[model samples]
Target: MKVGLVWFGDDLRSADQNILWRAMQEVDFLVCLYCMEPHHQRPSRYATQGMSENRRRFLQQGLNGLNATLAKVGQTLFVSSMDADTSLNLILNEVPISHLYRNHHGGWDEQQTLKRIENQYPDVRIQIDHGLSLFTPSQLPFNLTGLPESFSKFRRLVENVDSTTPLPSLHKLPPAPSFNIHNIMPWQHQITDNHSAFTGGEEAAMDQLSDYFSTNLPNQYKAMRNELDGWENSTKLSPWLAQGSLSARQIKASLDVYERDHGASESTYWIYFELLWREYFHWYATRYGKQLFLPGGLTGKQTQGSYYAERFRKWSQGNTPYPIVNACMKQLNETGFMSNRGRQIVASCLIYELGIDWRYGAAYFEEQLIDYNVGSNWGNWQYIAGVGADPRGGRHFNLEKQTAQYDPNQNFTHKWQGQVYDSQLDSVDAADWPIYPTSSN
Candidate 1:
């Protein structure tokens, strides 16, 4: 029997998954696959692990959710540890596959794997689709080659495009599918002893989305989105979005429905606007690939310095002596999440105040964040570090000024001060946190 194998990458969700849906249509029997790539969890030249325990746990939850959903439809996601090329070769040999389908992952490793699959199995029909962003290249105002450098320019050109761009429909799985359960190989690398906060699966992601919009949370998002005090202010849908457990289009569609049935407000519109911002970054990364991850960034003067493991450790551990920045940094270290405001403050402190390398900061985020999207994380870091697309770069957040503006009452500072580090900045006589250099991604 001709069978289809659906490859899962960072895109872990079953819903709105073009590859899964396409596989269902092409083969009478099908299977889904995910490989825990070793490189993803290992440290790069930056001397930090690629992912943290909190992120791993969150992904596990999402994966579990995806597996449960698939089981209900009489199919299963077979997860293994072999690299994509080796795993695909083994699966193709065992499953009698006629086609291989997957979503387009823009990472360098993923691109290389796709090439290997095509060259190795020239006979197999491999279908790839774009479902990660709200605006795919075809639907954009210009080809990626001609895409604008500034986000404002890009947003202005593509903001009003029709939502219905013929997205692939989610398909029902067959009652039973040909299997290779026993043939699964052991993971090539050592699984980390640490666990992550978010689980990797579809059901958990759907649960998160349901909770975010099913209540008054969406209504309160705009008001509290900038608050670093808690998680209630924002939808916190990024981790799901990053892993493809949820699509930007799906979230946008739901927002439209929510606004129509409920009343449209600034909060609702703002969330959609941010999603578009995220969509902009995705396209931005695609339009300029390796440059986004570079030290000089897409737009900066490249500077290299010693990787002072000590200062970086203090910063990452949230003991950097700056109250607001430390509090946000502590939150990220503990929970694998920080508010957007928090991200800006801490990242600014790292690149500008600490005079640390921007690459170290970027890699640190890549290692810790559950919602670590190469495009968004690196793009924002580069922008903040004065390297990326920002016309004017390097945001050196004044701790006193920021605390006065965002935590005027000092409640936020007081609450988190002793928890992570001494309330060093709380002292009136302390020098305003030092600003070291001009920088961005």
Candidate 2:
């Protein structure tokens, strides 16, 4: 019997999972696997302790759901903390692996890893399918090479294109192919910190979608999305989407149905527009690649002066005296999330307000956020830092002004300002504003 091996990464769900779907079609027996990179526990550019405990716990929960789904369909989900290259080699030597399948993530590190694997195991047939975006790059009207330099142009061309790619359905697993294999790693079971309030798995993602589209909250999304004080204000699907627990297409489809069955309005389209923005970032990263990670970023301009790790820490911890900025940072530290408006404001403060390098801030977010996607995080950092597509150089948010607009009554700021949320927040105490060298600074 032909054997198929799937090395799952960010694409965690069973539904609409092209990698799993294609694997089932190609081979009679399949081995589903997940490899947790060993380096995940080390200090990253942002979090010194690696991925925060809360994010990992949430991810573990999602992995459990994925495993259960596979089990229901007669498949076993094997997991490891091994490096991709080493693990793929082991699979090749141990199993009758005819093909290796996975999703194509745009990050340079992930691409590099794939290249190394193909080089090491040249005989295996490797397939990369689109499982992340609602519409894959290949499925888009324009190629990455010809993708518009500006988001608006890209948005215009693809706005009306059919995003009808159906989410792949799960199927029963054939008997396991004969192989000399080690026992599957047990799930890293841990209770997620209640502070974060985000759950994992395809089930949780779909449940959240159902709740969002439910009549009680559907119409209020537009007005509530910006409110920072309560979970009721936002869809909160971002963590799931960021971690691959949810697919963008699924969210878009649900929204579309809500519009048709319920009624379309400015709020309905606004959510779709936000999804487009997410698409723009993905395409932007695919087009730009490593440039997105550098200090100057996509514009090719070198950042001025030296970077201070101390100052970067302050911003990450949210201790900077600006209560509004600190409050948003605190929320992120405690819950692994912040509202969209909160994200923009804090990111701007790190760049324009703190005068630190944008990469420092971007890296910090990547390490902490449950929804951290390379494209969106870095793409947004470069945009806010004035290094990416924004012709205006940078998008700066005035903290006091932002506080007035988003947290007008200071309720959002006050919610997390003191006692409970300061463990990490105190690291970046904003006791006094840094002196700017120039008026712009």
Candidate 3:
């Protein structure tokens, strides 16, 4: 019987997955695999690990759901902490694999890994499906090399182009090949807090999407998206979207339904607009390759800021003098989530006010954000640091002005600042305190 393997990377869900669906159709028997790379646990240049506790927890939840879904269809997801190359080597040795399928991620490292795998195993038939974006590269008006430099230009070209309809969720799978694979690694699970707003899994993603659309949230999204805090302010679909538990095309399909039922408005259109921004970055990363991660971004312009360890530590800990920046950072540190407005505010403060390297800030966000996307995270940092496709050199947000506009009454600031300040005080001694005013004070 023909044997095939499906390697789950960022694409974790069974729904609307072309790679999974195609693999099921083409093979008599299939083995589903996931490799938990060690790189995720190691510290990055920014002095932060790739996956934070919150992100790890969320990922584990998603994996559980994926595995359960597969089991219902008489298949089991084989997970390993071994590197992709080594894990695939072991699997290929055990089974006479006829074909391998995986989603095409645009990161330079991902591309390099695929190349290395193909070189190592020339006999195995490998098929790559571009499942990450709302529109495939072939569907785009321009090729990767010819992608527009700015988002507006890119949006104009593809705005009218139809997004591919999401494939229905797979309910059946080919029988798993008989194999005694005992070396699977344990999933690192964390106990999530009861009050946590986000949960991982395709079910959770759909539920959030359903709940958000059930109300007038999408109607007011454009006006209230910039609010620093509140669940109702924005569609919280990003974390799932980042992990591929939610597909961009799936969201677009729902948006079309909402517009047909309720009249289309700027708010509804803005949702598609943001998704286009994500699509732009995905292609941009593909075009630029490793340059997206370099100090000099796509433009090859060197960042003016230098790395300061102390400043970076303070920034990560949300101890900056700017209360607005602190609030945003603290929110990220605690929840592994932050509003888009909060991200921009804190990112600008790190690059412009703190004079720290933009790459470090980008790397830190990759470590902290549960919703982290390599293209969006690095591309945005490059934009803010004046190294990417921004028409303006860079964004420099005035902290006072931002605080006044977003938190006029200091409601958000006071909420986060008190927690951070109290935590800082707990580590200090009386000698460090200024009970009596010193001349310096």
Candidate 4:
């Protein structure tokens, strides 16, 4: 029996899919899989261990939604309790898999995993499609190594380059192996409904796109995107985008519709512009590889600050002196979501005001955010700390100034209980007796 394996990672959706399409054309039977790695359930070296509860719940929803889609085409998602490497070994051992297929992921570790699979199973035909980003590697103006050093430079080169149209939705797929099909639990679309504040699947993502564009919300995105809090102010699609349940082109496709229905405006253009920013980081992470997580980042120039536990805890829990930062932190803790503006305010506070290592802030975000993407999360922290792509050294927002501007009425702060506390920024003074903060990853 010729069997192909579709290993689902960050890319969970079935619509506009490339890997599944090609797999369907060749394989007599296919098995879909998603592996929940051990470390993802444990804590990391920073404030967070693994994925946050909110993040896990959202991921589960994404899986359910994807499984529902696959079920429609006579397939099911086999979620294993092991990590990717272990799961692949076990599956390939049980069945002589003819091929392996997946979408390209930017994380260095994710790429390495696939590379190892290719080397270990040379006979297994490996196919990876670059469907996650708006543009594929061949579509880029320059080679991956020659990617622009800054977002502005990258923007200037690609802004005129149009995004490709998303492939049409899939109506059929290869059947799962008869022996493997019965054991898996099935999910129907009815099992998932819009009950919580946000839903995780591709179905929910498409609905959000349709509903947002059906009204005048896209027209106001640019002006309201900076607000401290408001649903209509922004697209609120990051969580879905981060999970890969909603492809960037899927969102751009909606923008195309909205533009056709109602003429394009600056707000509409800004929507695509933000997508370009995301596309830039996807390439950035791929280009920098291990350096994407380094203290000096891509530049090899180290900056100030190390890990101070007490200070890190206070900053993450929303107990710092800055009310705006406190409010943002608290909002993140309560919900897996945060405004983009809030992320900037809290990240600045962690690096500049509190004197904590920027990686701690990045790691904490990786733990808590429902929308966390390895490239966007780490790349962004590096950007704010002046260790990444920012043309300016880094951003140091005046908390007082930011507070007056975004929370003039203090409504957001009050709702999140962002009360000020008087205390020194440093947990330990330069006593010859006190130990230095540990800065290792």
What digit string (tens of lDDT, one per residue) describes model 2 on residues 1-441? 688988888878888887777777789988887887877778765435677776787888889888888888888777877776667778788887888888878777788888988887788899988777768765688777887877778779888876865566676665567555454454544455454567788888889888888855766778888777687887778888877878888888888889889898878877887788888888788778898888888778876524655556666776776788888888889878878888888888777767777777787787788888889989988888878878788888887788778878878777887223334322332666443332211
Selected candidate, larger lDDT, 2 vs 3:
3
Q: Whole-model lDDT, candidate 1?
A: 0.75
Q: Model 3: residues >4 Å from true position, as ranges?
A: 185-193, 418-441
Candidate 3 lDDT, 263-315, residue by residue in tens? 89999999999999999898888899999988888778766888766667778
Candidate 1 lDDT, 93-133, residue by residue in tens: 77777888887766656777899989988999898888777
The lDDT of each candidate is: 0.75, 0.77, 0.85, 0.86
Model 1 poorest 10 in a row by lDDT: 185-194
**lDDT ranking, high to low:** 4, 3, 2, 1
**Residue 66 CA displacement from its true place in model 1, Å:** 1.2
Q: What is the Cα-based lDDT of residue 55 in candidate 2?
A: 75
TM-score of each: 0.87, 0.90, 0.93, 0.93
lDDT of each residue in 1-441, candidate 4, tens digit only: 679999998888998788998988889899898887888899787757788878878988998889888888888888877778878887887777998999999999888888888889999999989888999888889999999999999999998887778877678888877544222333433344344578898988888878888899899999999898878879989999988888998998899989998999999999999999999999999998999888889878978979877678778888878878888988888788899999999999999988888999999999999999988999999999999999897899999999999999999998898876547545456674444456522
Q: Pick the candidate with the highest lDDT.
A: 4
Clashes of 4: 3
Extract clashing residue pairs from model 2. Answer: 16-168, 196-335, 314-428, 319-428, 319-429, 319-430, 320-430, 321-430, 386-393
Clash number for candidate 2:
9
